[model samples]
Target: MSERQQAEAGRVRLASALSASGALTSEWVEAYQAVPRDWFVPDLIWPGRADGVRQEESAHRLADPARWWEAVYSDIPLTTQWDDGEHTGNGRGTTPTSSNSMPTMVFSMLAALNPQDGHRVLEIGTGTGWNAALLSHQVGDGNVVTVEVDQESAAAAKYRLAQAKCAPRIVVGDGAKGCPDGAPFDRVIATCSVRRVPYEWVAQARPGAVIVVPWAPEYGGEAVVRLTVGEDGTASGRFVGSSAFMRLRRQRAERPNSLAYLSGPWPADGVRSTTTLSPEDVGGWLAMFAVGARVPDAFPLVERYADGSYTLWLHDTAVTSWSTVDWEPGRTSYEVVQSGPRSLWDEVAAAHYWWRDQGHPGFERFGLTVTPEGETVWLDSPAT
Candidate 1:
């Protein structure tokens, strides 16, 4: 088929799928149809797997038009920039820095934002400007402002937005600080994820304004939170759904390697034990979120062996504690070794059990309340 024919066919198929999935709601359907994702996507791209954790080989529009169009029209995200635009060549970089987010995530977050006509909206990440374009279409160009940390990305997005005739104010700066000049916004949305919702965003928004952001704890797992700014200058709301966006640049965690926490070789001054709880139990996304919410300031890393067994290493941000749990096939219990002040495994197990006792609630059951003092993740209600 011709390129135009391919584009139309793919667009129709994707729109149908998204509509069936209930992500592409009627309100945003016009914007979705008008703002083609290809206009913002670059020539060379790395398509992410449907699982959202891995990337496939690069697809270039010039070299492989069919694959490029397929990826653009697919629901999955496409990684456009890697390692803050430092890494070169066709191979994947150490990290995916910028991406055209998956269509489901984009539209779902937009639906959660639910901006009205003429409502001033502030967008945190302008990865490829597709989201900014869509927002512009929904709520006029003059009322939208998008902040991007990467200058190169900001320039590219600006060009794309201009070409699409959707001109939202694009600010090249720290997205965490937000655009204070455009303060008193009616709505705020962040394409990037944050460990803490920057108070600047809350401060800039008017009372009763809504802030939709992908929030993740230090340990792992993440979800998009739909918070309403209260008269008291706080934002509180439940997690709308699961999400896996890139961390906001400024809020990205400084995770030390396991070697940094070791005082000696091998076990490294560790005490060993065993637990009835399997390592696999605490490794799922939701499980990690539950554990991370209660545990605080700790993260996990996995070291897999050729035999398919793996060691789950837990480390605190302070580097004062470390723990390891071994998992192999058909193991009822796992070996555990912990060192330093905090008993990491015990904390994780306790948190996991607490979640289980609470009926293993999904993201919707959990809520976050961000106050001037701090943020709290609560189950069922904030009082808890």
Candidate 2:
């Protein structure tokens, strides 16, 4: 089939799938049809999996139009820029800095935002301008302001938006600062994920305005949160659904490698022990969320060996402590080693047990409340 034929067919198939899955709702169908994903996607792209973690081989529109079209229309993210545009060529870069987000995530966030016909919307991380275009379609172009931290990405997104007849005010600056000139917006949304919801977003929004964003803790696991700006200068809400997106440039954390935390050679001055709790138990996305919520300033990394066995390394952001858990197949217990000031594994295990005791509550059951002081993740209600 021709490229045009493939594009149309793929679009139909994807729309059907998204609609059936309830990600693409009726309200956004017209906007989705109007602004095709291909218009924002570049010629060379790396398609991410449905889980939003892994990326497949590069698909070029010229060399392999079929694969490119398939990737464009599929309900998956397309990595457009890598390493803040320093890495070049088709090969994957050290990090995927920007992407046209997964269609399901895009629509789901839009549904959560629930913008009105003329509502003013502020978008952070205008990766490929696809989201900005979609928002411009839902609420008029003049009412939308999008901020992108990367100047190159902002320029490219501006060009695509113009081609698609979308002219939302594009600002190139720190997205965490938000667009101050466009203050007191009725609604705010961020395509990129943030470790902490910048208080600037809350301050820039009018009282009662809704702010939808992908919020992730330092450790792992992420979800989209729908927060309503309160009259008391606070924002709080629940996790609408699970999400995995690139971190906002300003909020990106500097994670030191495992070697940096060690004082001497392997297990030097370290305490060793064994535990019945499998290392695998605390590695799930939701499990990580629970542990990350309770165990602050800690993150996990995996080191795999030539054999199937691997070690999970937990490090504190403060660079003060580290722990290691060895995982092997069919093991009733696992070996753990700890060093420094904190008992990382013990804290993780305790957090995991707490989550299990609560019946493994899903993302919806957890909520976040951001105040001038800081943000708090609560269960069922903020008071708890």
Candidate 3:
């Protein structure tokens, strides 16, 4: 089939899938169909898996048009820019800096925003301008204001928006600032994940405005949070669903090397322990979320071997504590070596038990309350 046919077919299939999944609602189905994700996506892309953070190599339109088209139509995210546009070539970069988010997630967040006919919207990230265009269509072009941290990405998205026959104000600035000139917007949306919901976003939004953003903790895991702005510079809401998006540049966490945590060789100045908790138990997205919620200032890194086995390295953001849990297939117990002032493995195991005790609550059960002071995550309700 022709490219046009493929694009149309993709849109139809995506719309159907989203509708079936209850993400692509009737209110925004036309906008999803109208704004072809491919129009905004770059020619060079790294298609991402739904459950995995790694990309499966790069697919260039010139070299592999069929694969490119297939990736664009699929309901998965496509990594467009890597390493803040530093490292180049066909290979995948160290980190995925920006991406055209998954269609389901894109529409789901939009659905959460639930903008009115003439409501003004502030978009934190304009990766490809597809989101801004969709917002422009739902509201008016003049009613949408998008901020992009990277100038190159902002300019490229601007061009794509113009090509799509829409002209939303695209600002080249930090997304956390939230376009003060467009203050008191009816709704605010962030395409990137944030460690903390910026106070500027809440301040810029009108009272009762809905703010949809992907929020991740320092430990690990991420989810889309839908917050309702309060009149008093605060926003509190429940997590609508799980998500994995590129971090907002300003809020990106510093990931020091795991070796930095060690003062000497393996097991040096360390304590050894064996636990029935298999390394496989603490893996997966939701499990990470549960552990991250309780364990602060630490994150996990996996070192894979030639075989399926690997070591899970837990490092504290302060660079003071470190722990390693070795996992082998069909193992009843795991070997753990922990060092430094903090017992990182103990904290993680405690978190896992806590989550299990809470009936293994999902993302929907968790909520966040963001104020000028800081953000607090709670299970079930903010009161908890």
Per-candidate TM-scores read 0.98, 0.98, 0.95
Q: Model 3, 106-184: lDDT tens per residue?
A: 8889989999999999999999889999999999999999999999999999999999999999899989888998887
Q: Sorted by TM-score, highest first, which candidate order results?
A: 1, 2, 3
The worst-scoring run of ten residues by lDDT in candidate 2 lies at: 48-57
Better of 1 and 3 by lDDT: 1
**lDDT per residue as tens, model 2, 89-207:** 88888999989999999999999999998799999999999999999999999999999999999999999999999999999999999999898899999999999999999999999
- Sliding window of 10 residues with minimal summed lDDT for model 3: 48-57
Question: In candidate 1, what are the lDDT values of residues 1-384, reduced to their tens digit?
Answer: 999999899889999999999999999989988898889999999998767965659999999999999999999999999999998789898989999999999999999999998899999999999999999999999999999999999999999999999999999999989999998899999999999999899999999999999999998999999999999999999999999999999987767788999898888799999998998899899988988899998889999999999999999998899999999999998899999999999899999999999999999999999888889999989999
By the lDDT metric, which is better: model 1 or model 2? 1
lDDT ranking from best candidate downward: 1, 2, 3
The alpha-carbon lDDT assigned to residue 383 of candidate 1 equals 95
Off by over 4 Å in 2: none
